[model samples]
Every structure is written in structure tokens, then in C-alpha cells.
Target chain A: MSIEHRDDTGDRFGMWLFLYTEVILFSGLFILYAMALAKFPQQYAEASHKLNIYFGSINTIVLLTSSLTIALAVSAIQMGRVKHCLNLCWVTVALAILFLVNKYFEWSAEISHGIYPGSEQLAEMGEGVTSFFNLYYFTAGLHGLHVLIGASLIGVVAVLTAKGKVTSDRYTLLENSALYWHLVDLVWIFLFPLYYLIL
Target chain B: MTEHKHEPVPYRTFIQIWLALLVLTGVTIAVSRVNLGALNVWVALAVASVKSSLVIFYFMHLRQESRLFKICLLVMLVILAIFIGMTFIDVLYR
Candidate 1:
């Protein structure tokens, strides 16, 4: 049996195709969010105002910085700087964890205030506010899940990178991981303003 | 088969783009604080679009990717736009 060789360009093309599907999936949710906003403009504004802009902005910066670190990790490996690449990957993972930590705190603060979905406080609120929190939880929760998956993916790549399996000559895995990390950051870019800023 | 060789993007470029993204995030927050009425949403979204574009173009190296990838992205975005537009038609009128 002949072993099929890897094709870097083809691999990247496939990754991009998968990414397109992800975009569409998230777009569906964004559509729901937009429709809800349109339906309850006043409520959305009021609900959005309840979000802490400082926390949101800090998380945005964290994700953006992580994106940069991951990008640099790819470049580092491309240049055969394995140690630098590993360091950058670890930094990216750390930043992702930090983002989640901040999110946990933010959500806990809201939940303690009974602003979470299905809470009595949210139940007392009108349908618009209910819709706002629902969309907020769904969108941000999905994004957080992606972050976890992406970080773990990068973590595996980092291990492979340390084992010399993902070398400069064969860094497609690292490159693809960076792409996924960037997509996570890209989603947050839209989520940040929609949920935190657009009051 | 000859291995494809990619030009390593400079570290400085990534830093610069990161700085730009942070600045844009700050700008969006500041802009949102103002009472722009209906245009507020538009402005926030526009700023987000710019930030995402920068991430895609530089951080994701979409600019350096093949034309096919770019076309795929454009098409996906067009489809998303159509979906949103049609949904808005229903949402706004009904």
C-alpha cells in the first residue's frame, strides 16, 4: 500500500473551507441576534448597558493579543525558531485562559445579580430583555467553547512541535492552528461591540 | 514534489497590527459612549468590521493566501450579507 503524502496548500484550502462553514453557522446566530435587537431595540439597549464595557474591552484586547501571539508562533516556526514558537504558543494559550477567567467573573457577577437566563430576575424582565440575555449567553457561550477547543488544539500542536513532528518543513498543523485562533478572535471582534458597546 | 515555502511575516508587522486592533477597540468603546442615535450601531459595526479585516488580512495572512481562498471568503461574506438582508426585510417590516 502506498502512503499518500501531505499537501500543504490542499490542507490549508480544506481548513479555509471548514472555516467558511463555521462562519455561516455563526452568521445564523448573528441573524437571530439582529432580529431580536430589531424587535426589542429599547430592551437591547438597556440590557447592553448592563454589560461592563471595561471587562469586555479587556477581553477584546486579550483575544487580539492572543491572535498576534499565535500568528507570531506560526512565523517563528516558519523561520525554524522552535523555542520561540513554543513560547508563543504557550503565551497564546495563557491569554485564552485569561479571557475565559475574565468571562467567568463577568458572568458570575451578572448571575449573582440574577441576570442569567431562566433566572427569576430575567423572568421578571420583558421579552426583549429575556431575548437579549438569551442571545448574549448563546453567542458568547459558543465563542467561549470555541476558544477552549482552539486552545486545546494549539496545545496539541505545541506538543507535536516540541516533539519535532511539526517542523519548519511541515508546519501546516501550526499554521492551521493559528488560523483557528484568529477566527476565534474575529468572532469576538463582532461579539464585543454587539453585546458590550452597541447600547 | 517541491515543498511550498512561505515568507515569514516580520514580528514588527504583527505588533503593529495588534496595536491597531487595540486602538480600534478603544475607539469603538469611546464611540459607543456617545449618543449617535441609530447611527451608533452602524458605527460600532463599522469599527468591528475594520478590526476583523485587519485580523484576516494580516494576522491570518489572508492577503498572502491564494486567490481561490480570497474568492471563497468573498462568496461566503456575500451569502451572509444576503441572509442578513433578507432577514432584515422581514424583521423591519413585520
Candidate 2:
């Protein structure tokens, strides 16, 4: 019986294809956002003013740095620097957690002010404000979920890397996970301006 | 199967890219405060598109990927653009 070997290129190709589908999924929400903005430009702009750009900007830098760390981790493994790769993976996870922590505080502030999705105050503000919060919560919440998933995937890959299961020759898991992490960062790149800065 | 050689990118390049992204974030924040009227959204989106391209080309190593992968990504983006464009047509006219 002949055993088939693993194809790293094919593996990465599959990941990219899946990412394209994810892009299309998010594009649907973006279209909805654009339509809402066009319909109620003034109200959307006013609602956007309520967002704290400082927090959004900090999260952007945090995610961008994490993307670099994850990319460097992939480079480290490809060059047989397993320890370095593991350390970078840990840093990526820490940054992702920091992003979520910032998101928590930001959301807490908004919810405290009764500006969350489905809150009486937001709903009373009319359709534009209500739709703005709804899209804001949904898109950012979805991206946050991706952050948690990417961080956990990186965490598991880091353990495997430490155990030498993912070396220079067999590091597709690490590479694929890094790609996913970058996608999370990419999503946030658009989300930041769309939600926080476009007022 | 042809084995594609994996090159180890220099650590300095990653740091440089990170620094560039940070600077761009600062730029976006600073520009948002200037109140460019309706052009504000376009400027912000353009900056974001640049930032995303940097991540895609460098951090994600799309630049090093095979031509097939690049073509697939391009097609996907074109489709997304069409979707956004069609929606804008309806929204803008109505």
C-alpha cells in the first residue's frame, strides 16, 4: 500500500479559498453598512461621532503588531528557529487578548450609556442610529470572535512547535494559522475606519 | 510535485513594516479630526485600503505566493467590488 504525502502548497491554497468565502461573507455586511450610510448620512455621521477613536486606533496598532509577530513566527519556523517561533506566537496571542480587552472596555462604556444594540435609548433615537449600533456590534463582534479563534489556534500551534512536531519541514500548521491571524487583522483594518473614524 | 523554496524574511523588514503601519494609523486618526466634509469617508477608506494592502503583500506573504493564488484573490476582490458597486447604484439613486 502506498501512502500519500502531505502537500503544503495545496494546504495553503485551500486556506486561501476559504478566506475568500469569508471575505464575501463580510462584504455582504459592508454593503448593508454602505446602504445605511447613504440613506441616513447625517444620522450615521452623528452616531459615529460617539465612538472613541483612541480605543479603535490603539486596537488597530495592536492587531497590526500581532500580524507582524505572527508573520515573523512563520519565518522563524521555516528557518528552524522553533523557540523563536513559539515566543512570537505567544506575543501574538497576548496582543489579541489585549485587543479583546480594549473592546470589552469600549463596549462596556457604550452599553453603560444605553447605546447598545436593541437598547431602548438607541431604538428611540430612530432607525439610522439603531441600524448603526446594530451593524457596529455585529461586525465588531464577528471580528472579535475571529480574534479569539485565531489566538487559540496560534496557542495550540505554539505548543506543537515547542514539542518539535512542527519543524522547518512540517510547519504548514503554523503557516496556515498565521495566515488566519492576518485575516483577522485585515478585517479589523477595515472595521476601524468604517465604525470609528469615518464620521 | 515541485517543491517551492521557503525563504526566511529578514526580521528588520517585519519591524519596518510594523512601524509603517503604526505611522499610518496615526495618520488616519489625525486626518479624521480635520472634517473634510464628504471627502472624509473616501480619505479614510483609501488609507485603510493602503494599510490592508501592506498586510496582504508583506505580512500575509501574498507577494510570494503562486500566480494561481494571486489570480484567485484578484477575482474574489473583483466580485466583491461588483457587489458593492451594484448596491451603491440602488442606494445612490434612491
Candidate 3:
């Protein structure tokens, strides 16, 4: 019975431990961002102004909405509304897709203008500007990867919920997935300002 | 199913937090519009901190977690702060 006994709290704590390490991983990039900013403060300001604030702000709202839906999905399952929970989870996933699509268009625009890393255009712009674009692409690319992973995790949770493996009384998986989704949003909350807002 | 009994947050609360987050999103963009000189970066970071706190506590359910979880989070944050401070200090002295 001990082997079969489930400890939901322990499972959650395990998830939190994983989350802590994920935060640490991103902090490493943030440290690099600060170093690069210090090295090329002028290029940082100029490069930021060229970024499309419309895309960044719109994506921020989209991710925030997804966070709300995922949280509500957890609450829905806890209340035994399994269908509602599944629908909310799908809604959250849809928003994640929307966010990624927007990112695609944004990156395409930058690339079309010959703004990508290693391009002759960027090389002509000097080392400071080149470094700024490099950091922007690397940092935002990593964060976008997280959004993709988080969305896939939620999709798995949704499938489990539909099969009744995740339920009102036993929802550690759903909670863990929601926690990961919220963390994705949390990272973007900082990235928005750092990349687009503060010059 | 080990004695699972706890009050789940109401749907309204999540909605309210979502609204607040959207408003903060607007505020951050609006504030960034103004030229705050050297204070712009600090202001942006401060607002971002507040927004993340709301998500961490309410959305992530950190408020309902045990003391150990809270301690772990605090410790992680402290380490992050130390890392950030050391990086800036290194830049300043170099």
C-alpha cells in the first residue's frame, strides 16, 4: 500500500523544485543580458526602438490571458467540472499558438529588413548593434521555446484529464502543468520590459 | 486521494487578477513612453516585479503552499539577487 500511496503534496514540491531550477537557468541568461547592456548601452537603446512594440504588447496580453485560463482550468477541475477544465486548457493552448504565430511574423519582418545576426547589414552596424541583436534573438528565442514546451505540457494534462486520470481529487498533474504555464508568463513579464520597453 | 480537502480559489478571483495584469501591461507600455532618464530601467523592473508577484502568488498558488515551499522560493530569489548584484558590481569595477 505504501508503494501505491500517492503523495500529492510531495509531487507539488517536486514540481516547485524543478521550477526553481528553471528560474535559475533563465537567470543565467539575464546575467548575460545585463553584461551585454553594460557593454553596449547605446546600441541597446537604439536596437530596442526598432523592435515592434505592437507585437510585444499584444503577445504580453495574449500570454496573460493564457495564464488566467490555465489557472481557471485548475479551479474547474478542482470543482469537478472536467469538461470545462479541458476546454480552458485548449483555450490556453490556442492562445499559446497565437503568441507563437505573432512571434513568427515579428521575426520575419526583422529578417526581411536584413536585421538578423551575421548579415552584412548588421555587420555594417558595428559591434555594439550586432551584440544587441544577438542578445535579443537568443534571449527571446529561448523564451519562445519555453512557451512551446509549456503548451505541450498542458496538452498532455488535457488528454489525461479527458481520460479521467486527472480528476478533482487527484490533480497534481494539472496543477503542475498550470504552474509551468504561469512560469512561462512570468518570464515574459520581465522580457517584455527588458527587451521592448526600457531603452 | 490522501485526505484532499482545501478551498479552491473562486473563478472571479482569477478574472480579477487577469484584469489587473492587463492593466499593468498597459501601464508598463504607457510608462515606457515617457522619458524617465536613468530611472526608466528601474521603473520598468519594478513594475515587472509587481506583475510577477501577482502571478506567482495567485496564479501559481504559492499562497496556499507550505512554509517549506515558501522558504525554497525565498532562497532561490536571494541567490538570483546575489547573482544580479555581483554581475553589476563586476561591470562597475571593471
Candidate 4:
């Protein structure tokens, strides 16, 4: 078998294991979210409405574009275009930075406005609503942590590629890391609607 | 001709997948606007499932991958679905 086959098998197994951990990690927050939402359906709905859809939408678009960039990077590698692959990896990193910047602004604004989990704004909303806010912060905060980790993983791959550590045949790091990045993006795709667009 | 020449890479497939994702995003947003009551969760999850399948199939290259890998992934998701389903039952009932 070719190197790509072995590489693919190894990476797929590794990625699946990584994804299992991720499933467990996110399951914690999902359980809390489900319980909180069930206890305070209307309050959770109202709290979700307070979120800024414009920022959420822009972040989604950015993530989608990053996914495109990373996919193209993989394609470039398979086609034996090393430089193009590196360039696309950098583009994906840039988009991730854009996403973090947007998230920071959104979080800071929400915090300053006292929309934090147990702040007065939440207290005024009632205990059930306060619990919803609590879950929101916990879940979104956990997701943000994953985003940071994913960005760092991809950023390391980009830097390595830039330094010539990766080539067309030796790009498993990029491929696997990109798989992780896309999973992070996938989680947010569901999260955006659950947290931002619910009626 | 070589026995294993690579086909021209399907960049268009990626583009179409991206466009489909955007459409699904719109569908999710619109579906949320409708108050389906208990069914709203199913609608959202269904749209998400479609969006996820698109990414897994095209973006992640699962479609062109080995059958073993695809089967393993499906098994993983099935297990996840079972866990989520059981949790929701407890939440909804209790």
C-alpha cells in the first residue's frame, strides 16, 4: 500500500479517538444545557434572543471559509503543490484569528453589559433564566476553549509547513489538524442556531 | 496510461458543498422562526445532521475513504445518538 493509505488509516483512527474525547467533553455541557433549557424553556429562548445574530452569522461565514481554505490546502498538497498548500494553510489561520477576534468582541460586550451567568441581568431574569445564562456561558466558554486549541493546532501546522517541515508526502499533521479544525467548526454550526436563532 | 492516475481534483465539489452549507444555515434559521413546539428540537437537529453529513462527506473526504473508516464513523455517531437520546428522555421525563 502507498504511504497515503497508511497515513490515512493511522490518522483516521487517531482522529476518531480524538473525536471520542471531544464527544465526551461536549457531552458534559450538552447535558447541562438540556437540563437548564428544559427547566426554563421560555427564559432560555429569551436569553438566546439577546445574542447578536450579526456577529454569530459573520463567525459562521468565517468558519465556513476556513473550512474551504483548509480543504483546498489538502487538495494542493495531493497535487504536489507545496507552496500553494502553505499559502492556503496560512489563509485558514488568518480566518481563525478573525473568528477569535469577533468572539472576543462579542464576549466582552456581553460581559460589560452584565449579561454574564450570575450577574444582575441574569438575576432579574429569574432563577430559571439565570440557570440558562449560566449554561450559556459554560457551554460557549467551553467551545471557545476548543476553538483556541483548534486554532493553535492548525497554527502550528501552518508554521511547520512554512518552515518546510511538511511536504506533499509528509502532510499528515496538516490533514489531521484540519480534521480537528473542521470538527470545531461543525460544533459551532449547531451551536449558532441553538444559542442565537431560536424563537 | 498509468494504472492509478489520480483524477482531476474535484474543487467544484467543495464549492457546491460550501454553498449547500449556507443554504442549510438559512434553513436552520428559518426553521427556528417557526414554533414547532416539541418538534422544534427535531427540526434543528435534522438540519444540523444534513449539514454535518455534507461536511463529513465532502469536506472531510469520508465519501472517498475506505469502507472501514466510514463504517467506524457511523458507529461512533450511532453511539452518540443513543447517548443523546437517553439523556433527553431523562430530561424530558424528570
Candidate 5:
């Protein structure tokens, strides 16, 4: 074996670097949102009122719980509790599915009301509300994609753990997946307040 | 250089953080209902900052990361904040 070696800390550092990029990527969209809201504050608040806060709040809880489960899964693996780790990961995955299912219903309800980007019904609502819903769909859609990817990453990590590829002593994959999961939660933490809690 | 192992975070700590997050969520909801007018948005964002901090420091284990990691995170956040802050400044001034 070569004397040079890789360590988890370095791997985690790289992961954080990548996450910083993701943060910048989303910040670009948020800047757009801030400007749009600034230009049409009243219309933005009116548009925000249309969003179902109950749905948003429930989804928030679901995501927060998933974050906990995944964090626990990482802890379980660190303690060498493979089976427990597996179970927690699956639970996290299930919570992700629950969040998506809840989101689907939420989206369907809004869509049935003729609320989507570029829909004829949306265009009739005037420009500001249209922009609001359009941004809503875009941000929420991008975030949903992240949720899907994070769940799949965790799922793959769980399988690797089961096969002995990842272990108590070597679990960079698990830790990184947990970090990604938490990032998803991080984004939603902002989204819930900005979109759903309009005063 | 010698390698070091990470200490596994306890299950109870995770649970505690989870509870704290839920409570913060509830607090934001209650604050929003109080009709703080123009201040509502800032207040909402401030609470969100707190909530995200909890996730980063605890859930993502940034609290235990090396100083370099923390510095990098602060740098990234500061850069983003500058971008966001400048935009708000232009909006307010124009």
C-alpha cells in the first residue's frame, strides 16, 4: 500500500466546499426573489397568502424529522450499529417520500386552481402574482429535486454499509450523505418562513 | 501526520436538536400571526437564520469541524450576505 493516505476530515472538507457552491447557486435565485418582491411588495404578500401554510408547515416538520433520522443514522454507523443504521436510513427515506407525497397533493391543489407558471389562468392574475407563482414553482421544484437526490444518496450509502464497503471506521459516504440531507433541510428552513409565514 | 477518529454524536443530542428546531418553527409561526407590518419580513428572516444555524452547527457537525472549516463557511456566508445586502441597498435607494 502507498504510504500516502486519505482521511475523512479531508473528504468532509471537500464536501463542504461543494456545499458552498450549492449555497451560491441557490443564492442567485434568492436574489432574484428579493428584487421581485421589492418591486411589488403588496402583490407579493397577496400572492403569498394563497399558499397553504398548513401544507408548508407539515412539510417542514416532515423534513426536520428526516434530518434527525439521518443524523441518527450517521451516529449509528459510527458506533458500528449497522442494522440500526440501516433502519434509520430507511426511515429517513420514508420521511422523504412522505414529504414528496405531501408536496404532490399541495401542488395538485394549487394546479387545479389554475396556479402555475405560464398557465392561462396565472397570466390573468396580473404580472406580479404571476411572477410570484413562477418563482415559487421554480424554487420549490429545484428544492424537490435536491430532496430526491439526497434520499437516493442516503439509500445508496445504506446499501454500501450493508455490504461492508462502509463501516464504523470508514464512513465518509454516510457522513457526506448526512451533510447533504441537512443542506436540503437548511434550504427549506428558509423557504417555509419566506413563503408560508407572510404577515 | 496521524489521523483522528470522529466521536459519534449521541442519539439524545440529536433528539434535543430536533426538538429545538420544532420549537423554533412554532415560534416563527406565532410571530407571523402578530402582524408586525414591515418588520415581519425581517423578523421572519432573523428566525430563519437562527433555525439554519442550529442545523449547521449541530446537524451538520460544523461545531466540531476544524477552524478552517468554520472560517470557510463564514467566508461563504459573508460573500452571499454581501450579494444579498447590496441588492437590498439598491432596492431601497432606487
Candidate 6:
């Protein structure tokens, strides 16, 4: 039945290996998060409770919808619907902007309250609270970096679509980029709960 | 490319997943209100794990991929689970 091509297999394997590196990168931050949560459970719980759940929930929905659009974009490309694919990609990008905007307000509110890493609010809360915010900023800063990068990739995907570089038969780059975007969204899906929701 | 009639994307599937995610989010929020103490954390994590798996399987199309890819991913997952389990045990228990 199925014939295997070494070239295709090799490319896929390489892509997965690269994903492994990404996993390792995020795992480092996760380790720090776990340690901090364990060391300062009360402070961490309090800090988490202060997170704006309305924004957090809305951001999750936005990211989830973006994931769906990107998946549809990939599906369109596979089906040779070039125009549809491009439109869906743009939709995904717009949704990402919505996410970033929500993140902006969320962070701005927290920062205004002086809850940033090593700020006055943290100082008043004492050592554990300070460390909790430290971990909060550190872990979330890295995840924010990832979101920024994913947005850039979204731009690139749009540019490629406009230039007619991505086609049904040659959409590996688009597919892989979309995969990375989904992973970014997936990470946030967990981080929202870990950092904001649970006590 | 294979010759075939074009079909509409699974709009229903997408909507179903959206509803499922919304329901899960509500469930998580409700659970947070109940405060099962330390057990609440585990409950939240369990719910998140389920949500993430649904995303990976349906949203990411992992279930439709080739068997080889699936096997490789499974192996990786098992290893990651072991690694996380060991660390959590060390941190929480020891």
C-alpha cells in the first residue's frame, strides 16, 4: 500500500526535532514556575486570584478561534482553495491582534497597581509574594516572547500567501508555521489556568 | 493531486469544539468557586489536561496523521510524562 519517500520523511522528522527543541525551551520556564508555585503557595495563590479572569477568558477564546481559522487555512491550502486560505490566514492574524490588545489592557492594569516584578506592591507583600511576582513576570515574559514570535510568523504566512508562494501542493511551510502557532496557543491554554484561575 | 469534488470545511465540528471549550472554561471557573482546598488544584489540572488533549486531537488534526508520526509522538509523550511525574514527586513529596 503506502510508499514512503525518504525526502518527505526526512523533512518531517527534522521538523519534529525542531519542535522538540521548542518543547525543551518552554520546559525550562515550566520548571521555574513549578518551583516558585511550590515555594510560595499562598503568595502564588493570591497573585493568581488578582489576575483578571474576564480578560484571561476572553483571550483564551480569541486564541482558540484563531487556532480554528489557521487550521481552516491549512485545510484550504490542502484543498487548492488559495483565496480561501489567504483570507483565513488574515482572519487568524486579526484574531492575534485582538489577543495582544487584550493582553495589553490586562498587563497595563496589573502594572498600574505596581504588581510587576520587584515593584512596591510586591515589596509590601514580603518575601514570598515578591518571589511569586518574580516568577510570574519571568514565566509570563517568556511566554509573551513566544506570542510575539508567533504573531511575526502569522505576518510571514500572510506575506507568503499574497506573493503566491504557498500552494496546495507546496504548503509544508505554511502547515508547519500554523502548527507552531497552534502550539503557542496551546501553551497559553495551560498557562491561563496555572497562573490565573486555580487557587 | 487527486481529483475530487470540493467539500465544505467541517463548520459543525468547529462549533462543537468551541462549545466544548466554553463549557470547560465555565466548569473550571465554577470549580474554582467551590474551593475543594488542595484537591481543587488537581481538579483544575485534570480539566485542563482534557481540554488540551481535545485541542491536540481535533484542532491540531493529530488523530488524522500517519501512524508513524502518531507513534513517535506517543513515545515522546510517555517520556515527558515520566519526566514530569518524577519531578513533581520530588518537589511535592520529597
Cα lDDT, model 5, residue A18: 93
Per-residue alpha-carbon lDDT of candidate 2 for residues A1-199, written as tens digits (9 for 90 to 100): 9986878899999999999998898889888898888788988988998999889888998999899999999888888888889999999999999999999999999999999877999988899989999999999999999999999999999998888899998888998999999999888888888888865
The sequence of per-residue lDDT tens digits that candidate 3 reaches over residues A1-199 is 3567778888888999999999999888888887887788888888898899999999999999999999999999989999999999999999999999999999999999999988999988888878878888988999999999999999999999999999998898999999989989998999999889865
Better of 1 and 6 by lDDT: 1
lDDT of each residue in A3-118, candidate 1, tens digit only: 97878988988998898898999989989988888778999999998999889988998999999999999999989999999999999999999999999999999999899888
- Give the per-prediction TM-score of chain B: 0.93, 0.93, 0.92, 0.79, 0.90, 0.78
DockQ per candidate = 0.84, 0.80, 0.81, 0.50, 0.86, 0.43
For candidate 5, what is the DockQ? Answer: 0.86
Model 5 per-residue lDDT tens digits across residues A39-111? 8888888899999999999999999999999999988998999999999999999999999999999999999
CAPRI quality of model 4: medium
Distance from true location, Cα of B12 in model 6, Å: 3.4
Please tell me which model should have the higher DockQ, number 1 or number 6: 1
Off by over 4 Å in 1: A1-4, B1-3
State candidate 1's DockQ: 0.84
> Which residues of candidate 6, in runs, are more than 4 Å off?
A1-9, B1-9, B92-94
Q: Which stretches of candidate 5 lie over 4 Å from their true place?
A: A1-4
* Candidate whose DockQ is highest: 5
Put the candidates in DockQ order, highest first.
5, 1, 3, 2, 4, 6
**How high is the CA lDDT of each candidate model?**
0.92, 0.89, 0.91, 0.80, 0.92, 0.76
Pick out the ten consecutive residues of candidate 2 chain A with the lowest summed lDDT. Answer: A190-199
CA shift of B30, model 1, Å: 0.8
What interface RMSD, in Å and to 1 decimal, does model 5 have?
Answer: 1.0
**What does candidate 3 score on TM?**
0.96
Better of 5 and 6 by lDDT: 5
Ranking of all candidate structures by their lDDT, best first: 5, 1, 3, 2, 4, 6
